[model samples]
Target chain A: MECYSELTCSLFVDGELTGDAARHLRDHLVTCQRCRDLVHALRAESRVLTESLRELPEEAPSPEAFSHLGFSWVWGDLAMMAAVLALGSTLFIWIDHLEIPGALEWFNPFSLNGLTNLMFNLSYYFAHGGTAMLTEYVAVVGGLFLVLLLGGSVLLLGRRWRLPKNGLGLLIVLLTFSLPGFALERRHEEFVTIAANQTVDDTLLAIGNTVRVEGVVNGDLLAFGRSVEVSGTVKGDLVSFAKRTVVSGSVEGRIYNFSQSLDLDGQLGHSIYGFTQSLRVADRGHVGDGIVAAAGDVSLEGEVKRSVDMLLSGNADLSGSIGRDMTVTGRGLTLTNTARVGGNLTARVRQLKGVHIADGAIIAGKRDVQVRVRKSQFARSRFYFRQALSFASAMLVGWLGLVLVPGFFRETTQAVGSGWRSLGLGIGILAGVPVAIVVVAITLVGIPIALMLFAAYLTAIYLAKIWVGAFLGWILLRPTGATRYDWLLGLLLGLLILTIVGFIPYLGGLVRFGIVCLGLGAFAWQLYHASRPAMTA
Target chain B: MIVEVEEGVVVEATSSEPSPLGAVIRMEERAQLRVAIAHLPENYRLPLVLRYYSELSYDEIAQQLGLRRNHVAVLILRAKQELRRKLAHRSK
Candidate 1:
């Protein structure tokens, strides 16, 4: 008799042979020794195959090898949240400083009667000022977000391509050299001077120990030096980064100054924006537009045709005329007798006693004095409302994360298994990044990199809580067979628990901090592993 | 054929008891099997490994390899046949 097919015997041994075929094979095996031996051989072969394959050492390195380090990928939703918060805060500060007519009254959270009122006010603002605001801020914010998203996607998805060690350096170099309008005149010397009679029709980029521009620069003047003295006419903008910047010449365009000391005795057709230790607008100096400065000390004796917005750490003394609104925030403010304001005068000081208005000081419009109050942030209902808003925003972000990168989201949550290691790494990263940022920023060449790092740092901090929440949710729901939208459910439950825990008076902060540390560490660990060359299976 | 049956019985007995000498022999056999599997063509080896090592079902292996379920079974069987032939030839 013909022996049963070996394929049937293999299938039978694998428990894949079923129904009548399996029954028939079993019945035949009772009588046929040859077929029985074939079946036995196949079973033995299967056992050997399984044992040999299972006993083979794993090709990939053990996860325990780098369990001490935590990893993280830049999450899109977190990035978006960071971007929106940054943009909103900047806009609020700008509007608050500019004291735009009626804008503050609408945004006053304390004045709102209830949630309905706040919502109504917000909707009203969106309806009325949305177009102007969106056009001004949204375009820039959207473009930046789009670029970030694209870059992040590439980094996350492009596993096949590896960036070389010096890739970022190469990119920076290429970008610097390949910028549009690369025909600008470059000057680097110990003491560079554009003599009085000379005329430069093109933009002048200068770096020196002391840069003196006494001649005409028909275009923008980009100056970097220990001391920058611009005594000549600059038809275009003047951007100066120096220890001491003195502008005694007429500049048709805006003046952007980053210096320790800025003395503006020159005529400025537009605004003067300065980040300086001390800013002085001399008696003869005049600004056609506004003066926006963040300085340690501000002495404004000149006339500003538009507005004067200043954030002073030390003191501000204004004796000159302001064409429109004048807003000053500082330790102390002084309005001299000769000080004249065409519009509103708003002073924000630590104490009302810090503001001094002379009897002869003229104000054409409203004079509002705001004294800073020190109180517990949690005491305010607005604080709770803000917290609720934050929770909702986080939920939205978490949902987006779950929808976009489910695999990564799950992996990141699972990575939190090494709790102590993640916490330790998180603590290191949280404390070390700022120090690294400062070091990088000190090298002016790395300013862009420093900014990028700062953004990433903020994004990571915001994302830490979400990661913890997701992990918590997973842990709680794992026994329930969390297979469908498990991450979303986990995130929701985890975030709710975290929020409740955070409301606990004294222990809440400590618990929250620990959670953040764990999340950060896990992310860092995952990020490190992700960046490594993947092991071939 | 009778000798092959006796060899099968010895293998089954050795695997169950695994004495020191039997363990050594089993290790050598496993090493030989690994080499034979590695030498098998990708078409057969992939399905076999996916079934035995990964512990994937035939349907899953078919889905992963984008082959029919029956095709996956056939490929696995062929892979085992090839491995057995290699091992037998080496022993000879």
Candidate 2:
């Protein structure tokens, strides 16, 4: 019979052999000294190995462990997100109909698509209330933002890229140009022209000289010459400062005027107020509320449905109807035959002429008239008080995150920013190879090398985005001192400055694409560096 | 206890003699020891000297392992031989 092998001994130990077969293996062990010794050694080694395994660390020991945020790490997070979303949705759906007032409102009965819209609208509704609602809105928005940011970060960080030296050099040049103060003045214009008829959005539409509108602007309008006319309807408010300002069309909202002469010929759906040097209103125009002004000459040929308080240097003309009250302090006053003062009229005028008041003109309040010839008794003496209520809502999810996962934010931020280059490089490599292969196949030998180089370049894009995302997240979260906040705010003032300003057809695309490439390159460098050691590990 | 064919009384009866029945009994004993050792975990490692002394006679192991006679003699005379014997006997 053959000698019992180590394999046979192992099988016997595992109780594979039965009855006499097992007995036979057992019999061999009584004589074979070498086999016995080998088994003994193997047994001792196994025990030690098992014990050592028990002592392995539960978590990554070093901070540098986070220096390489890989797919597995992010996949774990994604899984958590999916779980939480599921739980939240389920809880909301189950308990929403129970009428738990405060929380119940969040449970919209609408379809899933409608729920998003509802949530958006509900947030806007709460936006009007005090800081509490604003706070809640910010919190929700910040959370949504973070999830998206992290998702993108993961994708970007995992990429890699390579490019030709010249391409790299060009990227560097573009990055240098992207810095502030590289070129300050973007577009030069004292007066910009808007065509006679064109549709414009919220963008700064240029037309004529020295015409400024700070109202709830709707569509586009034409501006021409020294006279500034807003004849077209404005869905939003209108704010203008001009030599002579005219609003012939309807203003759905408030109108703030800073001009030498102000004229409102059309109806104002809301209030109209101004601070001007000279104010004039044609007979066809009207004022929705009281008019406050400091001017040289104040003339109103139209109707004032409410009150009017004016201070003028030369003269004041009133041919319009005053519904409530009229107060004027000017050098001279003139009331035409068409003037009908429904309410009291208080004035300080040097001379009064053509003072015509129809017998039927109702004057409910006491009427007093005073001629103030002195130049010092101007309208600047009166100040209209306004309530100053400031609103600041910062949606801090970090505090929440700190409550939930103490180290998640800091760790994630470090992982994203520090490793941005390597991560981007990884992604570029992952994406580039297949794309390059496809290109190579299509173009044959003509593009194989080029495709390879392009693949290298693309692999670095995610690195750039990861770094930018981390910086943006940090900047957005930093509760630095007031001055730091101010500085940061100032720094971010141009978040989309290039986008808005660079929309000049072909040049815009070039500039933006160039900027994008530079950003991608920088991130790619960071991600590439970050990802290397991780790959080795 | 004192049954012997040649010169010495067989102590501990670790293996059977040259008879057919003795060979079967010796094979069974050898297999038992192997089973015990094989049951241990994969990472475990026993001391080589202890294992060899407990499992094999000095002359047989010396021949197989290419060790000198004096070395095996010395290993058996030392406390290592006694420790292995006691451990094996206790385990069984």
| Candidate that scores best on TM-score | 1
Model 1 regions more than 4 Å off? A1-178, A181-192, A197-205, A413-458, A472-537, B1-92
iRMS values for every prediction:
8.2, 19.9
- Per-candidate TM-score against the hidden true structure: 0.54, 0.28
| Candidate 1, B1-92: lDDT as tens digits | 11244434745765676478857777888867876775577678777876776667887778877899888888889999899888999999
Query: Candidate 2, fnat value?
Result: 0.00
DockQ of 2: 0.01
What lDDT score belongs to each candidate, Candidate 1 first?
0.73, 0.47
For residue A103, model 2's alpha carbon misses the true position, in angstroms, by 57
What docking grade applies to model 2? incorrect
Restricting to chain A, the TM-score for each candidate equals 0.59, 0.32
lDDT (C-alpha) at residue A291 in model 2: 75
lDDT of 2 by residue, A284-335 (tens): 7876766777778777888777888887777777777777878888777667
The clash count for each model shown is 9, 70
RMSD of 2: 27.5
